[model samples]
Target: MGSEKDVLVAAAVFLFALISHSEGIVGGREAAAHSRPYMASIQVPEGENMKHECGGFVIADQWVMTAVHCMPTGPNGRKVVLGVHSLSEAEETKQTFDILELHNHPDFRESNYDNDIALIKLDRPYTTSVAIRPVEFMRQGGTNPGNDAEVETAGWGSLDNLGSRPDKLQEVTVDVVISALCRRSDYFGSKFTANMICAQRVCPQPCDQLYKKQDTCDGDSGGPLLFNGTVVGITSNGGRKCGQLKKPGIYTIISHYTRWIDGILGLQPDPTPEHSD
Candidate 1:
């Protein structure tokens, strides 16, 4: 995961995904088939058909991670749809599972959106395939890509602020906005915190920072924010309107809850060294 080739690959993604000229996607493009095998769609039952509610990503064969707000309220529980690129297509590799259990961070609060993370235990393990696998989490001790570094986020989020959802998965490249800037009164203000991160599409040459750009909107909540080929954050929320000027997409920083996540996964903590007399 620390290889130089991985960095080059990430660099390549941003190099070709230059700033967009169109208002496309709030500004994004359709992703390639099976390009992101770890992507999952959180869907709730609507009569005979399942309705897409939010996005998630597989962290392990049987565990999926998402925003705490994405958890269903009633007993009906949401389903985890993996290995899919389009919500409407019945692809051969697509796999769906009823959630066996859900673990939301105990301190999570919808009001301030702090500690807004959750994990889903699938009824069964995901089928490993060219179209199904887990996304990489930043290993312990890994560092963030830092401010203004290009990162990629994908989802079937609304194509516009008016609630236009799409069938095909979409992806966009954005730059990490330093927290201090996002914490300004004009931005998220007191609502922003260290545990949260903000990112937005970079404007093309000569454009201002607030220039309209691509961003995740409704139905994109609980999705992943990948930096350097690993999961580093989860889509939490945005402003009253999607792609609103100055409201960069806010995310729950994954590293802040790694211990809780690892504990829930039953993983052992790193051993401490013994002292000699």
Candidate 2:
């Protein structure tokens, strides 16, 4: 990571903090070939009129959730589009909605990426479509995942190590690694906190070199981390490289922030109507 000033600026501009010591990831297959599908796609405002960069998703009829880094406190007008499959507006069947309110986690800090979560209220409820719908959260007192759990991830990020952004959304499957191993990884270690969860692949002892490509990079941030049909975490950060060994992907643990989110959303433990499958 860079200095606080540089990290803040890059976050404000919706650019990845491509700090030094970064390198290329393994080529060919993606690490998340069987992960769950993503539910949100938000376009954040940038320099001038109506332009945006960051992506987000609608977590409720009126609320869209995403990474806090995508939008720092600013005067920018961030708009969101639900039911969108492609970045192109014409390809989307649902109409775009204005962001009536923006709420970054009160404790969010761009410098260190702590409390990297935010929620936006849409001006209008979009018509749900196959491409878009409010993803249901695991019911209250629901099942929690164990070590090495099977999970899926989806996003509209870069497809290859050196490739440009994907035109359409993509989905993949990956496995959760032991939290202890993940915490000890270079990506977390000193910076790891109870708010973050780690996920990665567990290759067989005599694995082929192809298993090396299982990880997330930039652009995949703010996406969902689903396990057993429920979102357990939200993509936050990882190693600067695309897929570096001993450096697992870090996500904001959703359960840890449930009360904070509920306080913001003003809901009970089981916020129904918005959480139906």
Candidate 3:
């Protein structure tokens, strides 16, 4: 609370970046049936029905990784659907569970969209199958993604900004842009932080302006950004619209919070030396 203008600016930023209500997966193709076993559809209780709110991915036996902005605070009955392809069809491969705990990053700042990661513990461990499994995520000491690395993100979000939520899963690949470019005065600028990764769906060589763009949106929040079969980031937020070249999709770098995740998962390393002197 510095000044009245400052407060207004902060509120505007929060509203503009509050994309949890947008649909997702612009300029993407429908994924194959049961192809993405680790994909999770986060649902919240709406009236008497559960509504799809965000996307997530299974990281461990009972842990689902997503963005903090995707989860609801307090002890609510949240549902997760895994190993699903079509939302309209009742597939035999789908696995459902209730969330047991919500672990949002303690440093998360909604006003600035910082540290937007979260880990949700399910009521029970998922049953392993060919169509249901966990995805590996970047841990501490892991290498950062290379410049222009192609990453994949999928969800049942909208196909455009018109709020058309898809009934099936959709996927798109975007190139990782350098932080320096995203931090430019015209781009995200100072609002971009080191803990964030910016990715954009580039047009192919000799492409046209209307060639169609790709990106994550609305219901896609909290989904996995996979590079080389491992999740390196979580879908955080973006600009006013989806699939815009200037407004690249931003993600929460997972490696930066591996220690916190380990503690929550009960995998923290022992402080004592392995061998006594």
Candidate 4:
């Protein structure tokens, strides 16, 4: 076994490699246009360019939820694009909004990525329609769907480990890894917290070697982890290599922070309503 320092070094290396390689979904297929209406692409100004830094989902008329790490310090001319499938081409249904306010979890820390969630207030509200809609969050007291649950994650991140960011949105099915099993992994181990959720691809026979090949990559950070048609988690991070066997992607468990989220949105946590696709 490696010493704690060695483990930390390995973890740091893993994070750095993933961050440098790609920023999108790996092993996911192209999604149907406007299939995920709430999907939002968070863009940050980088010098003279506006780069897509992370993904998010509209939770309300003028609010978006994403990972706190996506904007560690604060928003910098950050804007969100919604109702679009392709990033390069403009769709008539697409709408862009400037960020008015940014609210990160008070306990968020770069170290260990605790409470890695944030909410952004849009400069204006979007007109709800078939192509632009908000997603419902997992209501309070909602049970964790369990390990066997098949969840869908969507993003415009990379399609592989080569750092190739996709122009079209991607969606993939992932299995929820039981917290206990997830906590036992060498990559995350005890670092797993209640605020975090783990997910990975389901493997067939000889699972060990086949477990890899599907995951959220670098550019996917702050995307939605959907279960039962509801937003259950927010993409946070993953292991060094995209979809590395035994290493699962981590997400900010949205249900665990209902109070904080409600506070930020200035609304009470109401029971989740039945939503139509």
Candidate 5:
């Protein structure tokens, strides 16, 4: 009975992570190899599993980064599995672990979905292997990503909006759309700020509705938006339906919050200036 309960707890954690990828975001960019990136496999609480989505990334051996939404309830009794490539139930690589502490952004606001970042302190440092290494951050001094850059997003969300959910990580490439285009949309509203960046299809024509599968959907939120192998944005939110045009994907612009991230992570900001020129 005790073992069965443990297995149930493990399933909840995986399910939450799967849901995080369900929420959509934008863009695709080429990644440069700089450091190791780790995905957080959160151990879900019993009933809250239905509300939360798993989120985690390695910043330190004992620390994982994620979104506030990933913890539907307070941080007690959660866990994080440090190293794994696939989160699929059928996959042989998945492992289960526990969370030590959840340090959510102090200014995190749930009302409008702003300031959604959070950090998870693991109960113990994860042992590293070839498949699982630590990921490097801008650490307050990295350059901003380009608007036209290509980025890659990986998650376990559904293959297409309103379709069957995926059990394994699904990676897709997207191009960053200029902020002006993203903000000007009637759907995004004036709330779109420098703190946010947007991405969408580079097509001159509209996509098919039934098969309009290029955009992020219900579970991709809180995932990494990588450009040039640097973390550029946090997968946040978008309009109601996925892949709808003039309603492009939106993200928490990483460059705009470097200081905040640095402050939280206790890292020094970059000394160099970023130029639009």
Candidate 6:
């Protein structure tokens, strides 16, 4: 029992780390309400209070996709809240559901966050509305949203490095960084795999002029990285600081894991392996 408790505690911390950023959003702005309808908040009980651990996205009526690292180890109260902009106040658009099941990828590596994707089965199907829509996934054979492409990311993560959780959701525009450049960074150093993609917050000015880093922090983990309004990546990991120079945020490329996801969703998995650009 003691060992089991220890494991649970460790798992809790890992989940927290995966979702919570000590250094918060570096260059993010408050998002408009209902602008990101597919956003889902994964919440877990922490003593007397419930905390948002990670961000996810609705894919189907009853399915959510998130990082495998955010999976709860023990049943200490877990649920997903959708269609809400504010975490503190109740809104008519808000819909909460208990998690019926969690399916982590079979090859997910905890040590390195390889294959860091998972599917969440909600207890009931969510009613579709303008404020509660599912996000489209990158289709098979779709062109990769290449390096330097601007993408949108949203979450209710911390506002700064001191760890101040936000009441309202925030958003930032980031650019996809070349994989080779990302792999060469001092922090990641060849750890990137085929399943991973790297992105960096768009600099306010060109690097040659002025550099202002923007990125997703702790609470943004498992959130969708949107390209052309479709989910291209899921937040995985980043540097110790939220927005460090050259330390691009890592994400689980959705296209690479479509087979695993399709298997869980009862859809046909594509036989051909996706090629990265």
Query: CA lDDT of 184 in candidate 3?
Result: 90
lDDT tens string, model 5, 143-177?
65677778766554545555555544455667787
Clash pairs, model 4 backbone: 23-218, 23-219, 24-157, 24-158, 24-219
- Model 1: runs farther than 4 Å from truth? 1-25, 72-75, 208-212, 270-277
Which of the two candidates, 2 or 5, achieves a greater TM-score against the reference? 2
lDDT of model number 5: 0.60
TM-score, one value per model: 0.86, 0.75, 0.85, 0.84, 0.73, 0.85
Candidate 4: deviation at residue 273, Å? 22
Q: lDDT scores for all predictions?
A: 0.83, 0.64, 0.84, 0.83, 0.60, 0.82
Candidate 1 local Cα displacement, residue 54, angstroms: 0.6
Tens digit per residue, CA lDDT, model 4, 1-277 = 8899999999999998765343337766778899899999999888886778799999998999999899988887888988878888868898889989999888886877878889999999988878889999885688766876899899987777778888888888899888887678566877787778889884576766523377888799999999989889999987887787777889888877777777777887555542211
The lDDT, on a scale of 0 to 1, for candidate 1 is 0.83
After superposition of all CA atoms, the RMSD between model 6 and the true structure is: 11.9
Residue-pair clashes per prediction, in order, are 1, 15, 2, 5, 29, 5
TM-score of 1: 0.86
Higher-scoring candidate on TM-score, 2 or 3: 3
TM-score of 3: 0.85
lDDT of model number 6: 0.82
Candidate 2: list runs displaced more than 4 Å: 1-38, 45-52, 138-140, 185-187, 202-204, 210-212, 269-277
For candidate 2, write residues 1-277 as lDDT tens digits: 6899998887866644331111122222322321222355666555554433555656777787788887776426657765655565465364677778778888876655778888887787777665656766544456657777877666766654674566455655667777777666454665777667777664568877544466666677888878866787777887776666677777776665666678788876444332210
lDDT of 4: 0.83
Q: How accurate is candidate 3 locally (lDDT)?
A: 0.84
Local error of candidate 2 at 103, Å? 1.0
